[model samples]
Target: MSAAPLTYTPLDPSGFEELAAARPDVVIPIEQTPAWIGFERALGRTPLGIWAYRDAAGTLVATASFVHVTRRFRESVVVINGPVWFAERTPAAERLLMDTVREQFREHPAVDPLYVRMQVATPQAPATGPIEHGWYEREIVVDLTPGEAELLRSFRPNARNSIRRAQRNGVEVKHIPREEWKEVFATQLFPIMQETAARDGFQAFDSSYYETLLTVLGDHLRLLVAYRDGTALSWLITTEYRGYSVYYFAGSTLEARSTFAPYLLLWEAFRVLKAAGNTACGLTGIASENYPGLANVTTFKRNFSKNVVVVPTTYDIPLDPVRYTAVASILAARRKAPAAARAAARRATGLARRVGRGRGAVGASRHS
Candidate 1:
């Protein structure tokens, strides 16, 4: 017998939850969830469409959520790992997903977008090696299927011993409830994030982002705090996606470094997520080679497993090449502005320091 026909139709969040409930293995980030799209819409983006692919038996096999991104009057329909499939990760299934979305974009004039950007978020590595295709191009995943001892056994001695030492020093990890998320953000997490960004030379978002995330994600958002002697030392922000938990954000106070609270905080998070039945805990994106801090973070992650995976780069399917290229170029240029400014500031400071030293030497000669 021939295979059943596959067809795509609009699906709501309820339908998505129903299907996802049946297929627990289809773990996708909360951002891809329909509720998240709704939150985005409430915050001003146009939600273009939502769809589900079903077999002839009328069972939903895959689901997708689409949102229209408009900047300076230019627009694009973002797929963002939509059409999440419950079927095996076969080429045909992936092909159908791409083909269906492309065909829809072609036939529908109302959904006209310069290009469709699909952010890949799968465990399976893409056929393409590495290119630019993600909000973050690389990430780390820790196996949580094994028991605590087995999981700890996989860690390098440094990470393992640090965690043990932190515990021995009376570091305690606790969950911060939603009501107190704002308080923790303002009082503890914010200052540490500022310190981290300054030391690492990265831009840090204000506490409002965490506030909105906590308000929207509700049960899916998990905040873990590492404390000692009544003082909060470090905190980690995580989200419970389909089958995995994502390590979204984290920071530690300067004093906490000596106690290694950050390492124990991670181990505590892994334990909680594993006990909650997640198959693995994704460390999310670490720095790439191009970034100076990548080495330190890469080594930190490798201490857990050498099995670090580089996910498929984000794919941009363009309908209007000229417009797409124009917009892409502008966005890329804007992204580089911050780094350029930092470099310029450093050069100016160095020049001023040299001039000060030269003047001081002449004044000393005059005194002699």
Candidate 2:
């Protein structure tokens, strides 16, 4: 008998949730969920397309979510960690997805994407070559299926101790919903983000960026904050989908270091994920051999799970003639510019500090 024809349709929140409910065993990343798409939309990004196909039983069994990002008018659609489908529906879903995406580029004036970057979350669509657009290649996935005793035993000795110590020392990790978090997030946690970015030498998003993030993520997002003696010490944002929860980049105050608040924060998140019936939790990106500075961070992730998963290579497949080459060339240039930019920034900051110190000394001597 021939395979049943699949009808593809745009996915709303309810439709996406229906597919999510249908695929209980599959762990679709939160980035491909409806809340994430809505979050992107709130940030002024266009949802290029999101489609789900119904199975013969009339259940939504497959999903493909894409977002349009325009950088200097070089537009592209990125399928963030998904194009999720059941194993049986892979072939039919793949054909419909490719056809629909191509149609969007060709016919839909609003979706004139220069390229399509996809990393299908299925065994059927394995990626190859270099990743053009992605957050990380390797991520740490911690198994949460084991009992609490087994989970603690799996953790590194130091990690286990830190969690105990944090609890004993009155360092609390609070799971605040979005609405409740607003009471303290701006005043207590926002500055920590800037401090973390500066200390780690990374560029951070604007203050307004958090508005889109917190508001649009809805219930899929969690605000985990570590506090010591009534003072906030660290903050972690976690997102859940299906049976998977992912830890995003977080911030920690200098005062939190002595208390080992970061370690405790992660443990709290792990506990919550396990209680939610999640089988695994992603410790987000970790350093491979390429980034030496991240050795310590990778070691921390390893404490919880020895299994480090490398997502398939994200390839940039061109759809347009004019902007694809332009964007590719720009990305190539940026790949080589980071180290030089860091060096320049350090030198400028050092010079500015010296100048300020010299002026301060001169003023002191004159006043005396």
Candidate 3:
């Protein structure tokens, strides 16, 4: 007996829902495509997506998209995120699709040093050697399977205390209606984002991008806002996918710190997902050690959730050796420059503050 031949094609928008239905166990949601499309639209670019199908059978088996990002170091890299496929497909099929995608890029003169970065939701790790990259540990999990009481008991004592304190302080959690909340988001959230970005030396999504996402995803998107004494304190944006809820984006006002509003917000999200029959609550990308005070955050999330999943940083599969080396060199330089600039800025600010205080004291003595 021989296996059926496979055919590769470009994925059409109409087939997205059916494809999503075929792979319920996979986390690649229908909205992910639209969300990527939205990102391309906002950025004014078109990303290449490759879909694998059985020859002439017309039934889709696997799908992957390649997004090309031009780095500051002048390197052209492609990231392939959320690659979804039927469980029945063999490892050979996945390899074939990847090879085809690489060849397609090679034919393009402008698409030099094509790199493939993937984060699969499946538990089974794919075999390596086709790409020059190392695999870090990754995970896909379900939390609601344990039930709510068990979930609460798993949490760290401080996390449980924070949640209880928020509830005791009369913190209210509610879904912000898309229409009414858009205006508040623009006014209240944008400034905080701008300040945070400036302080941290990173860029954030433009206000319009978030607005577009809300309109596109509709009910599948949920905005959990926490309030105390009629004042907005903290909020989190979650997306429901395949019987699981992912806590994607979050923000908080400084006033919320004292009341521990985020703890209640997360707890409410967990309760809502459990009631809706969702099997898991994904506490999306938490740093194990990098960010300041993030260990505390990681501990907090782990208390209510048993799965402390550490997903790999994206893996790069370089198609062109010369181009890949050039890009890597440039990225190393770009990262170093930022740290140098931040250190210089801190020293300059310290000197200016000292000079200003000295001048002010001398003038005050002269006046006296």
Q: Which candidate is the best by lDDT?
A: 1
TM-score of 1: 0.78
Better of 2 and 3 by TM-score: 2
Once superposed on the true structure, which residue ranges of model 1 sit more than 4 Å away at CA? 1-6, 54-61, 81-83, 88-96, 106-111, 120-133, 287-293, 329-368
lDDT values, one for every candidate: 0.74, 0.74, 0.64
Candidate 3 lDDT, 1-368, residue by residue in tens: 43455666666666765766766777674334645665565566556654544444666666665566654444333444445666454555555555555565666566564465554333222322223332233332447766678777767788789999999999999877778667767776666556545644557789877666666665667887888888778877777766877776677766676898889898888888888878887775444433333444455456565566765344455567566667677666677899989999999999999999999999999999
The pairs that clash in candidate 2 are: none
Off by over 4 Å in 2: 1-8, 53-62, 88-100, 120-132, 289-296, 321-323, 334-368
Candidate 1 residues 1-368, lDDT tens each?
53545788876778777877877766666767876776676566787667787667776666667888775646777766444666665655565555556666777767777766674444232222112444555678898999999999999899999999999989999988889998878877888888877876678877777667777776777899999998888888988876688888888777788898989999989988898988888886667653445565666677776667665555666666666667777777776898999999999999999999999999999999
Query: lDDT-based ranking, best first?
Result: 1, 2, 3
Clashing residue pairs in candidate 3 are 155-303, 155-304, 156-303
Q: What's the TM for model 2?
A: 0.78
